[model samples]
Target: MNSKKLALIQTAMKLFYRKGIHAVGINEVLKVSGIAKKTLYHHFSSKDDLILACLHYREQLFIDWFKQQLDAVPAGKAAILAIFDALDSWFNNRSPAMGEFNGCFFINASAEYGREDSLIYAACQQHKSHVRAIIKPHVDAFEADENKSNQLTDSLCLLKEGAITTAKVQAKLSAARDIKPLAASLINHPLRQANI
Candidate 1:
């Protein structure tokens, strides 16, 4: 992409995240981006097109950040649980200048675009699926049996989603960390009782 286009998208993303999609208009994006109407139109055919681009960009940004955090830990329970640690850091304003945990950009977009079939909503779902995909590997490695692995992966995903939503709603920065014990219980608990 051209520098101008990238700049526009980046600026629009910041405004959309800070202000909101519906709240921030194209005029604001243009003003903040400092790009001419022709240039903005040249890059994106419409505001909806730009919104989709922002969602795609956010998906990549979040997943890449998640991968880095997950990879920092060695594979196992530590790697599996690192997802929440990452979220905790996000919620705690670890990067005050960046992210600052605005309750999942994709989640915010999902609310803005309520139609299930809408591109915006689909992008949000795709972002979540990527997160689940990342967790699946750790789960498979932890659980030797394929069936057990699938079940554990689903549970972990639920825990992660729950933590995210709860943290946002309750304004609890440690919500992710707080859920660690429960997760540990699930992981430490063997799938079956031995000789029971």
Candidate 2:
């Protein structure tokens, strides 16, 4: 995609994610994206196609950002903590248009589409798998034993799911605060201090 088309996707994604995919129409997307209808249609066969493209673009950006954050953390305990650090960065950002930014784009878009057959869904699945892979090592480092590692990894996933839901409902990070203590006690203390 050219810079202009990529810009349209980026702009449309922010609008779609903020408002909703169903609520935001093609004209609004064109208005916000500052792109001509002819150009937009030339790039995307339909609104659905544009939505899929936006999702793919967003997914790539998210994966790149995640990898960068993961690489910055120290292995083992520090890496585990970096998960929360990344969440904090995501939640703490303040914008005039989108305030707290609590909603998960994948979850929201999936809910709006009401089905799982689009490129967007595929991108979301890939993101989830990538996140699981990132968390696996942290789980292993925290527990040492394979069974224990798997158990903790599952537990951490629960925490993540809860955090996302809670943020969505409450529109703030109170639930994330709740998860922190449990995560600290469950995954941090013993694991980081092990081998004593």
Q: Which ten residues in a row have the lowest lDDT in candidate 1?
A: 187-196
Which residue pairs come into collision in candidate 2?
A: none
lDDT value, residue 18 of candidate 2? 82
The number of residue pairs in model 1 that clash at the backbone is 0
Candidate 1 accuracy as lDDT: 0.82
Q: Whole-model Cα lDDT per candidate?
A: 0.82, 0.73
Worst 10 contiguous positions by lDDT, candidate 2: 93-102
Model 2, position 153: C-alpha lDDT score: 70
Q: Give the Å error, residue 156, model 2.
A: 1.2
The residue pairs that clash in candidate 1, if any, are: none
* Residue range 87-116, candidate 2, lDDT tens digits: 656666632332346477777877777556
